[model samples]
Structures are given as C-alpha cells and as structure tokens.
Target: MSTVLFWFRNDLRLHDQPALHAALTSGATHLLPVVCLPAPDERTPWCFARVGPHRRAFTAAALRGLQQQTTVLGNPLLICQAPPAAALPQLAQAVGATTVVCEDIAAPYEQAEIAALRAAGLQVRTVWHSSLLHPADMPWPASDLPGVFTSFRQKVERAGITPAAPLPAPAQLLPPLDVPAPVLQAVGAEQGAAAIQPPAPPQGSDARSSFPYGTPGCDGSEGAVLAHLAQYLARKLPHSYKDTRNGLTGLDYSSKLSPWLATGALSPRQIYADLKAFERNHGANDGTYWLWFELLWRDYFRLLHLQYGAGLYRARGLSELPLAQHNQRGFERWCQGETGEPLVDAAMRELAATGYLSNRLRQVVASYLIYDLRGDWRAGAAWFESQLVDYDVYSNQANWLYIAGRGTDPRGGRRFNPTKQAQDHDADGSYRRLWGTA
Candidate 1:
C-alpha cells in the first residue's frame, strides 16, 4: 500500500485545513501525519531562544489537541523534536513514502524548510490556505501588490473580493502508515513524547495577564480556539470591538484571536464568515467593519511577503536606509522592561510576565525600541518572535520593518512619543500600575 506524509506547519486545525484535505485526496492508501517542533536549544542571531517558553508551551497545547483529533479520525499525529529537513525525509523513507504535503508559508525560514525537503528528494506539495483572500483572488497580481496598505485594501474592496468559505473538518483521515516503534521514538515524536507526555500547562502564570494562556480557556488548542470565538461572538463583542480594541488591558479589550491564528488552531476565513453573519444579525457598524479591516491588514502583510521575499529580512528592509547599529545594552534593557521609560517599561514588563501584549502597547514598545532607544529593529523583532504566544513571521517582520521606516510606510516611520503615548493611552496609568512599572 502506498503511503504519504502529511506535514503540519502553522495551519494546525482540521477545520478549513485545505492542506490536510489535499493530503487525504493524494491517493495514498496509508498516511503519516507529523509535526516538527523547533529545537529547544536553537537561538536567534541575538543569542536568545528562537522560540521561547510561552510559544513552546502554547504550541505544545495545540499539538495535544491536534493529536487527539487525528487519533479520533483513526490516524495518530506524530510530534517530531528534530527539524523538518532532518526528520521528515527519514520518516518518509522509513514509511516507504516520498510525497509530503503541507501548508505553504511565505516567510524565509518556512520557505527554506520546503527547499531543504525538495533537496532531500521528497516531493512536497504545499497548499496556500493561511490568507483570508486567496492571492489569486486579488485584483492585482502579487508582483504589482500595492506598496501601501490603504491602496491594497481599497483595491480589494473595490474588487468585491471575499474569502472562500472555510472547508469542513474531514470525518476521518487515511489509515496510519505502519512505522516501527523504534522509528517513532527516534524522532521527537509528539514534542519529544518518548520522554514526556504533551507539555504540561505552564505554571506560575500572572493573574493580570490579558491572554492568560496555559490556563483554562486559553491554552492554544483548537477546542479552546473555537470556544473562545463562540464566546466572543455569543457575548456580542464584535459590535464593540472598535471601541474596546485600543484597550491596554483585559481580554475583552480585543478579539484575542491572533494566538490561535498564529498556531493554526483558528481560521481567519471562519472568523470572517462568523463576523459577517454577526453583522447581518446584529447590524453592521464601525466596530464590525474594523474587525474586517484588521483581517485585511493580516492578509496584506502575507501578500507583502509574497512580493518582497528575503528583502524584508534585511537590516534596512525594503527601503534604501543604511545598516542599523545594534544597541546591545539598550536592546537588553528594553527586553527586560527597565529602560526608565514608564509606559514603555510597563508594556514590556506585561509582555514578559504574560507572553502577550495589547496591540496598542506592541506599537508603543516597538516604537520606543526603534526610535527612542536607538536599537536595531531586527533584534527587537527577534525578541518578540521568542516571546509572543501569537508571534507571526509575516506580521512581526512587516510591522518591525514598517515602524523602522524600512518598509513601505509612506510616512518615513512611526515614532510614538512615549510621554504623549502614556498620556493618551494610559492617562490614569492603571495599565502601568498593573504591570508595576508605574
């Protein structure tokens, strides 16, 4: 019997999983579903973990949910501790399979992984399902993507483009490819499960956390992803999203969907559909419109990657700016939230304590690091990649580049005056007090 390997990337959930759907229909009689965890010891150029505790713990929770779902569908999900390039080809060989199917990620590292797999002689099929609007569905070609976000959004709206409805979860997947137990144990196998069961939920979480992940209702599982969305909509929060979105603290301040989106536990298309239905039932307003606006921003960033590729990762990004100097000490202090700037410090402390930060504060802290602290934007981006539970490659890289005036921002760059930002957003300083930076 022929077998195929299904590699899980950022798109983790079975719902609306086009890549998973593709694997099921690949004509293989048997299938092996696998996920490769980032190496724990891997460090970024800044010498910090490439994936930090919150990201690891949160992603592990997502795997546990995925493993459970796959098992219920008659296939067990294998978690590999090894990198994809090393582990996948070996598993494919062991299972007597040559084709591997997965979600297509546009970022440099993810694309490099795919390149490595092809070099290893395994046929890889990558399905693009992460974006809300299909790239092909856009009015403009990828190469001619509007440099500015507003232009992109205007074109999309004028073209009346809507995302394809999310695909339903398959009732079952192909039978598991028979691999010897030794082969399974050789790989990380369920986030290195031979050594431990799925990662235990993180402990000693801060009570003041807006996301409060690793606790009940916030672990990065598909079930929790859906549950959070159901509750957020059921409580009728979309109607007020715009008004509360800028809030600096608490879960109700925003949709809090990015974490699951980052993990692939949540689907942006499904979110879009549900929100549209919500507006129909409850009536459309600026708040409801803003949610869609934000979704467009997410898609815009992904498309930007499609156009720029590795250019976005450069020191100066897409612009012709000179190379930036890395302020090692300043960057370190900013990471620790001890830069003597009350608002920026509070935001950074909250980020460290909770693996999450408000979108408002994210911009503020990023600006403080780039414009005020005179730090290398890449290092700050790296720290966020290591820290955020919802860290996304396209968004993180694009946002950092934009703020540093290194990308397509018409305004050279955004420099949020820390004092002014504090007065505007934290007028009473409650947010700062909550994180004890006051």
Candidate 2:
C-alpha cells in the first residue's frame, strides 16, 4: 500500500485536524506522522535564545501531551530536531511517501518549506487550519481582504460568513507504518544545548506573572488548549474580556490564548467554536461573548501581514510613512527593562524574566520604545521576538508598524504615554512594588 506522511507543525491535535484527515484519506494503509524540531543556532538570532526559556519548557510539556495522543492512535509521532527544509526531503524519500499533507502556514519561512518540498517532485497537500474562520468561506478572497480591520469585520459580518464546523478525528487509530526514527532529537542533547539560565514559571500559575497561560512553551499538542478553553468558557470569561483585557495585573485580565495560536497548537476556529458553544450553553450578551471580537482583531493583523508581506517589515511599513532612525542606547535601555518609568520597566522585566507580558503593557512598552525612546520598532520587535512565548509574527510585526505610524491604524502614531498609563492602570503601585520598583 502507498504511504502518506502527515507533517505536524503548529496544528498538533488529532481532533479537528484537517491536514491529518487529508493524509488519512489518501487510501494508504500505512501513515507516517512526523514533527521536526530545529536545533538551536545562536547565529540565527531568531532561534531558541530569542524564543526564551519559559516557552521552551511549556512547549516540551505540550509535546509530551501530543506524544501520548499519537501513541493512542497507534502511530508514534517521529520527533526530529533539524531544519525541516533540509531534513524533510530526505525523510520523505526514506519513508517512500507518495504524498505529504500539512497545515498551511502563512509565514514566509513556512511557505518556503512547502515550496521546496513541492520542487522536489513530491505530492504536497496543504490545508488551512489556523484561522478563526476558513479562508474559503470568507465572502472576499484572501488577496482582497480589507486593509482596515473594521471594514473586514463589517463585510464578513454583513455576509454572515460563519466559520465552518471543525472536523472530527478518526474513530480508530490509523494503522502505523514500520519506519525508522527520523534523525532528530526531540529534546536537545548536552552538546547541542544553548548556554541559558533556568526556565521561568508556566503561564497559568496565577503567580502574578505579567502574561499568564495554562502552560508554558510550544509542546506541539492540543490538550492544554482544550483545558484553557474549557475553564475560560465555563466561567463566561469572554463577556468581561474587553474590559479586563487592558488590565496590567491579575489572572483574569486577559484571554491568554496567544501562545497556543502562535504555535498552531490551537486553531482560531477551534477557539471560536468553543466560545459559541459556551454562549449557547449559557446566554449571549456583550460581556459573555465579546472575546470573539478580540480574536477578530488578531485575525485582522494576520490578514494585514498576508496582504502586504515583507512591506510590513520595512522601517516605513505598510503606510510607507517615514520613520525616525534607530537610537542604540535607548534601544539597549528598553531591552534591559531599565527605562526608568516604574510600569514600563516592570513590564519589560516581567517579559525578560518570564517570556510574557500583559497586552496593555505590551502596547505601552512598545509605544515608548518606538516614540519616546526614538528607537526603531524593528529593534523592539527583535527584542520581543527573543523574549515572548506568545509572539505571533503577524501580530508582532503589524503592531510594530501600527505603533510606528506605518500600518493599518488610520490615526497614525498613537504613542502610549507610559507615565499616564502607569498611573491609571497601577494606581495602588501594587504591580510596581511586586516587580521591585525604585
């Protein structure tokens, strides 16, 4: 029987897995499921060090969960640590795969990998699995997506483009194929480990961490995502998300879904489905169901990046607006979390110490770095790239552009006044004192 290989990237769960479903449908008796973890390279500047330790640990935990699920499905998820572009082709040949199926990733690097595999004369099928709604169901083409979020939301809402129902997992395990382990380590060996400090607290600890989630890092699994959704919905958290989302402290302040969305461990559609179900179970009110509004904001940024591509990375991003030059010392101070303002510094410190920061603080600190500090937003973005576990490229890049007066925000250059924000959000000085303010 012919074999089809399912390449697991961010979409980690078997339930509602479109790519895995496609692979299994190929009339192949033997299924090969593989995960490629890239070895950390310091020179890359975008490797594990930039990704921070907290997320790494969280991801490892998620990966363990995925392994368990895959085992129950009767196929061992082959974990390999190597650049997928370099390793996947060889693995495909070794396994004698007739076709390759994977979740479509919009990022440039991920797109390049799929193209490279197709160039090697293999049948590669990609599925849309990340969006809150599938691209096909949208009233507009992906290319025609509105540059402004409100316009996009209005058009979609007016058209009533409800998201497709999620696909269900196979009832029984797909028969496992006898294949050798791909030449990659699931965890780094001592020789390959980076020189780094100990990992920090997981997101859901309620330990007063700036950014809190149920777990840490990208573990390549879906169970953690399910747990977080269940808890947040049971208590009807979405109804209050818009109000508390801007809060600087406390566990209930934000949705904390970014990390899962960032790693593809949870799809936006899945989150939306759960949110709607919760609304049905309870009742639909602004306070109870507005979380999806926030998610649409996330989707807006994603579509913005997809529309403009590398233009969003330039100094003068989407708007082509001129930006001031970089300030090295200012950039350095901001990265070190020594910006002097108590709230700003505390937020940055929390990110450096825990690889997470609250949404309000993220905007405040980002605005300060770009406007007050006279630093390049890209530098701030790179720093964020190194530190944030939930850092999605689309959100991070587009947000930087918006702050720098170069993206979708019609009111350009909306710089956050850190002192004013600090006073309003942390009036009692509790958050400042907790982070050891001056």
Candidate 3:
C-alpha cells in the first residue's frame, strides 16, 4: 500500500485544513500525521529561546487536543523532536513513503526546510492554506500586490473578492500505517523531542484580562475556540466589536480569536464566514464590518510576506534605512516591565503573566520599545515571538517594522506617547492598578 506522510506545521487544526485534506485524498492507503517540535535549545539571534515556556505550554495544550481528535480518526499524530529537514525525510524513508504533504509557509526558515526536504530526494507537496483569501483567488498577483494596505483593500473590494468557504474536517481519515511502536518511541526520544502535556488550567480569569484564554471554554483547542466563537456571536458581540475592540481590558472588548487563529485552531475564513452569517441575521454594521476589515489586515500581512520574501526579516527592513542601536540593559528592563512607565510596564506584566495583549496594547508597547527605548526593533520582535501565544510570523515582524518606520508605512513610523495613551485608554487607571507592579 502506498503511504503519505502528512506533516503539520503552523496549520494545526484538522478542520478547514486544505493540506491535510489533500494528504487524505492523495490515493494513499495509509497516512501518517506528524507534528515537529523544535529542538529545545533552539535560540534566536537575540539570544532567547525560539519557543519560550508560555508558547510551549499553549502549543502543548493545542497538540493534546489535536492528538485526541486525530487518534479518534484512527491516525495518531507522531510527535517528533527532530527538525523537519532531518526528521521528515527519515520518516518518509522509514514508512516507504515517496511523498510528504504539508502547509506551505512563505517565511525564510520554512522555505529553507522545504528546500532541504527536496535536496534529500523526497517528493514534497505543499498547500497554501494560511491566509483568509487563497493566493490564487487574489485580485492581483503577489508581485503586483499593492504596497499600501488601503490600495490593496480597495482593489480587492473593487474586484469583489471573497474568501473561499472553509473546508470541514474529514469524517474518516486513512488508517494508521503499521510502523513499529519501538521505532516511533525512539524517534520521539531523540534530543529536542516534544514533551507535550495538558497545561494546568489558569488559576482563574482575571476580570481585567481582555483575552482570557485560560477560561474554561477559551482554552487553546479547536473545539474550545469554535464554542467561544459561537458564544461571542450568540451574545450579539459582533455588533459592538468596532467600538470595543480598542478597549484595554475586559473579555468582551474584543473577539479574542487571535490565539486560536494564530495556532490554526481557528481559521480566518471560518471566522469570516461566521461574521457574514452574523450580519445576515443581525444586520450589517460597523462592528461586523470591522471584523472583516481586521481579517483583511491579517491577509494583507501574509501577502506582504509573499511579496517581500526575506526582506521582511532583514535588520534594515524594506526601507533599507539603518535601525536604531540595541541597548541590552534597556531592552532587558523593557522585557521585565520595569521601564518606570506605568502603562507600558502594566502591559508588559500582563503579557508576562498571560500570553496575551490587546491589539491596542501591542502597538503601545511596540512604539514604546522602538521610539522611547530606542532599541533594535528585531529584538522586540524576537521577544514577542518567544512570548505571545498568538504570535504570527508575518504580523509580528510586519507590525514591528511598521512601528520602526522600516516597513510599508508611508508615514515614517508610529510613535505613541505613553502618557497620552494611558490617559486616553486607561483614564480610570484600572488596567494599571491590575498589572502595574511586576
């Protein structure tokens, strides 16, 4: 029987997963589902763990949920410690599989992994399922994508481009291959093997949290996210999303779908579909429109990556202007939430305690780090990668570069005044009181 290895990358959910769907329908009699855990000692140029404990904990929770779902479908997910370049080829050879299928990530490191797999003489098939709108469905080619977001949005709207409806999870997946259990165990036992365990539930929801991912129905799982989405819509929340989205604290202030969206537990198209449904039932309004608008922004960032390639990762960014100096001491203090700026410190502390921050706070903190602290923006981006449970490579880097004036921003860069932001967003001082100290 022919077998195909289905490797899971950032697209973790089985639902709305085109890559997994392709693998399942590939005419292979058996299927192998694998999730690669990065080597534990992996470090970024900024000298921090590539995947920190907070992100690891959330990912572990997500994987446990994925493993349960896949196991029920008869194909258990294999947790491999080796990087894809090394482990995927070995697994393909071990299973006598000729083809490996996975989601195509447009980032440099991910593209490099695909290159390595091909170099090893294995056939690799990749499906692009990361964005809300499929690349082929875009109004213009990636190379011709608008440099300004407004222009992109206008052109897409003018062309009446809508995202494809999300695919449903397959009811029956291919049966597992007869690979030896000892061999699987040995593969997992290799150095950097993922130690996945269900994370401890959050002690309790802080009344002040904008994103309470630790709450019972809000945990990082496909089921949990879908349920949360339903509940949010059921409460008529979309009608108010535009008004409340900028709120500094409180669960109802924003959709809070980003964590699951980033981890692939939820799909952007899935969210878009549900938003349209809500509008049909409740009437279209700014709140509903803004949700769709935000989804477009997400797609825009992914498109930017497609257009710019490794340029997005460079120190000088697309602007090619020299970046600010790196101050190790200042950067360290900023990370620790000890910058002596109450609002910035509070936001940092909240992020440290919970792997979340409101979209408003993210900008505020990024502006503070880049403009006020005069720190290297890449270091800030790296720290966020290590910290945020909802971190997306394209959005994180693009946003940082925009704030640093090195990205697609027509205006030089954004520099938020910390004191004014505090006054405008936290006039009551509730947010600061909740997280100002440590």
- Clashes (N, CA, C under 3 Å) per candidate: 3, 15, 0
Candidate 3, superposed: residue stretches over 4 Å from native: 189-194, 200-208
The order of the candidates by TM-score, greatest first, is 1, 3, 2
Off by over 4 Å in 1: 194-201
Q: Is candidate 1 or candidate 3 better by TM-score?
A: 1
Candidate 2 per-residue lDDT, tens place, 371-391, comes to 888887878887777677776
TM per prediction: 0.98, 0.89, 0.96
Model 3 agreement with the true structure over 1-438: per-residue lDDT tens digits: 999999988887988999999998899999989888987789999888988877877776678788889989888788887788877777787789989999898889889999999999989999999899988998688999888889988888899999889999999789877666656665663332347764454422555556655676767788888999999999999999998998977778898888888888888988989888988898999989898888899899999999999999888999967767998888999999999999999999888877789889899999999888889999999999998989998899899988998988899799999899988999888889889552
Question: By lDDT, who's the top model here?
Answer: 1
The order of the candidates by lDDT, greatest first, is 1, 3, 2
Superposed on all Cα atoms, model 2 deviates from the true structure by an RMSD in Å of 3.5
Q: Give every collision pair in model 3.
A: none
Instruction: Please give the lDDT score at residue 114 for candidate 1.
Output: 98
lDDT accuracy of residue 316 in candidate 3: 93
TM-score of 1: 0.98
Per-residue C-alpha lDDT of model 1 across residues 60-94, encoded as one tens digit per residue: 78888888999999898888899999899989989
TM-score of 3: 0.96
Report the number of backbone clashes for model 1: 3
